[model samples]
Target chain A: MSFINVLSREINCKIVYYGPGLCGKTTNLQYIYNKTNPDAKGKMISLATETERTLFFDFLPLALGEIRGFKTRFHLYTVPGQVFYDASRKLILKGVDGVVFVADSQIARTEANLESLENLRTNLAEQGYSLDKLPYVIQYNKRDMPSVAPVEELRELLNPNKVPDFEGVASTGVGVFETLKAVAKLVLTEVKRQAG
Target chain B: MATEPKRVFGSLEELMTNPQMVMYEEEFNQIQAIVVRLVKEANARVVFVIDKNGQEIAKAGETDQLDTTSLASLTAGNIAATGGMAKLLRENEFTTQFHEGERANIHIQIVGNRVILVVIFDSKTSLGLVRLRVKKASEELNSIFEALLRKVQDPNRETPFAEITDDDIDNLFND
Candidate 1:
């Protein structure tokens, strides 16, 4: 749910980074937060367990740039991917304008990826949103892993809609901004479509 | 802003997905006026009108020292979490939340079941006064938003993004 403040000349949108546990969703946000210019980003807030697993969500607000004259601010968030946190994930998607499903590319996590994808669809549906209609993208993260599945395999399993998928090693920031830009672009384009 | 799942208007997709809330210049001033007036009537240190999604629509009173962006996000999260709790207990919604701090207290109200109205104050005012003022402010805010929504959904109305070009979007990533 993007908020367009005509008086303020600001467009605020929410994008959620979602995947199974330990798929580098937090790392993806951390990388973006670390590399972004201070003026472009706000404080990154993480609600996590003592061991650093995301407990609720991680929020990073970015002022990407102006679209025409409206300030395009994207609130980047990552859900706690642990299965039991389903309730939390649903809460975060309430007003989402875009989605990035960060898949762990390791062969061992293939089932987890599929299950999380199903969960994502279910949660979005609960909020009156469908994955196909939303501005959604997929990232095959952890490409540096030795046991990673081939990109072709990840695609066949994850990118059923073929929505601007990317290959990323989030720790090193590979494909991080590419994924962000891809989904953010889709979000803006969708906003325009809604207006038209 | 309403914690309840939206009641579909035309298509469920066209319902909530399009413009969840549109802030035009007209209603913006009315809403701002209510927020500003609430601060004075409630004797609040600060007042913020935030949508359920955490976008700060308007604010007044002393806010120079606050991290409003972060506060907006966290407040939405707080409301959503409590909304979740309400569901499990089989309640309609928990429309009001109060958090007392030693120095500054926070009062959050769900107005018209659509937006969050937050008032931050200290020892200068009583909760009774704040609540009474918020009740009046919430009614005014609700009517203004209802009008804004009616204007937004009118098929002939202009869209803020209608004038945006492909170049404008591409330029966003040019950095």
Candidate 2:
């Protein structure tokens, strides 16, 4: 949930990055952590297995300036994308203010992406949340990969609702901020909508 | 206070069902006071409160040497993991956790099932003493947050976000 601190003039919101295994969910967070100014970011914490796969989640907190004099902090998290990590994935979404579904565009990973999407919907539903109602965006990551599917095909599969979607190579940082900014804007807009 | 079954929801439901976890200045001061007192009463190095989602609500004591943001996030994860295990074991909720180190230790308690109360201590205090202090502090903190929730539910409460415009949001990322 969004934590609005009137005494501190700050707003903290959670945004979760989710997708299939090897979909570059952690990569997106790493890129953001690296590029963020030292002052605006907290230390990035990754709870990973010995193999470097996210065992639980990856967390990065960023202060993206202010809105109407309130400092805005977004705690960005990425679920371990492996199928067996469904429980961990569900936990990461506990207080999410927004979501970025980072679909690996490779032709071979389409099924994994769809399964993860369905898992997202069901897990969200269990928490009394509907994906259709949350501030959400989609990113077709790994656009630079040779075996990736066409953006059009990926959109038909994942972006049928046509939320703001980006073509990203998260490791290389292309479309990273665009996807983040889109969801962050949507989340703030959502909080504004609630404010009224 | 009658115990209510805990229901976890994300921001969407949190906004629609209850208000966002909006902290009023009045409630903030009360919470800060409780935290400050708890540190001294328990002979602890640090005492902080966080939402189940890992947002640091308030804290007091020797925190200058701590990365509280990371600490807050990981603590939540630890609780979430344990809470999952609780479910698998058919328990209502674990509600309390303790981890001991040679020099520093932690005690986590789920307060009213809404927030996590964490105390970090050292060899200076006994676990029994910390637990007693936390139990008393949890009740007080719970009442304050309960009042804060009710205050936020008032539809007419003034929020700075109400005046924020689309342009204002856009300008934040203009760089």
Candidate 3:
């Protein structure tokens, strides 16, 4: 859900990054946090375990400039992608304005990607949100890896709706901003539509 | 406008996502004043009023050392987790939570079930004093938000975003 505050002249939206275990969901957030200007970004918080694996979620508040005098602020969060973390994943999706599914591009993890996608759909449905209706995008992460699955294969399996998919190497910042920009644009467009 | 009887509360998500829950500048100032006063009365280092979706609506007191953005997000998450637990236990909702650290303590409570109020303090004051002050502040805030919601729900009120165009939204990301 997006909070359009007329008093503060600010629009706050929540966007969650979700995928299977170790699919670079957190990397996407860390890359954005590292690249964003200090003034444009707030402290990045990660609720993780001793091994630095995200236990619950990772949150980063970003100011993506303004629209028609209203500051556009996006709260970027990443759900713990491990299979056992389904409960936590459902919690993070509550009131989400947009979603970016970060799929691991490695050929070996294809099944994990598909399972996680199904999980995402089920979890979203539980909250009365349909993936087909929400502002959603897919990111084929770890694209730089030598054994990564071909883009066509990944899309064939994951991008059934063809909702603005991107090829990304999150660790190196490749295609990171493009993915963020794509999702943010869609979310803002949704906001406009809702207002009308 | 006719004033409807106010219910006990609704989910934070429902209140926040409602297009009618508009906050005007005048009402915001009133809320800020309440928070500022609460900070003084509680003798706390900081007080933050945040939407349940993790957006900071207003804050006061010493926040330079704090990462309020992250704090707000974490606080909401904590509240949500607790609320979930409450549901599983067949309770209405756990509207209040307190976490005490060695040096600082955090007091969190749901106001009007729409926003979370967080008070961060240290040894300067005891938890009892903070609780007493917060009780009074929550009541005032509840009424303020109640009026604001009624104003927002007024059918004749103007919507600032009503004039926004698709191009206007597209232009926002041109950078």
Backbone atom clashes (below 3 Å) for every candidate:
5, 0, 1
Instruction: Give per-residue CA lDDT, model 2, range B1-175, as digits (tens).
Output: 3332223455553554444778888899999999999999999999999988999999999999999999999999999999899999999789999999999999999998788999999999999999999999999999997787778877678785778898999898788
Local distance difference test values of all predictions, in order: 0.89, 0.90, 0.86
Off by over 4 Å in 2: B1-18
Q: What is the lDDT for A112 in model 3?
A: 99
Best prediction by lDDT: 2
Stretches of candidate 1 above 4 Å error? Answer: B1-18
For model 3, residues A1-196, the per-residue Cα lDDT tens digits are: 6777787788889999999999998999999999989999988889999999999999999999977788889999999989998878888988788999999999999999999999999998777677888889999999888899999999999998889999999999988899999899898877766554
Question: Which of the numbered candidates is closest to the native, going by highest DockQ?
Answer: 1
lDDT (10s digit) by residue, model 2, range A61-165: 999998878999999999999999888888888878999999999999999999999999998887767788889999999988899899999999998899999
Which residues of candidate 3, in runs, are more than 4 Å off? B1-21, B153-156
How would you encode candidate 1's per-residue C-alpha lDDT over B1-175 as one tens digit per residue?
2232322234654473346566889889998899899999999999998888888899999999988888988999999999999999999789999999899999999987678999999999999999999999988888887788789878788688889987889887886
For candidate 2, the per-residue lDDT at A177 reads 99
Ranking by lDDT: 2, 1, 3
lDDT for position A144 in model 2: 88
Candidates ranked by DockQ: 1, 2, 3
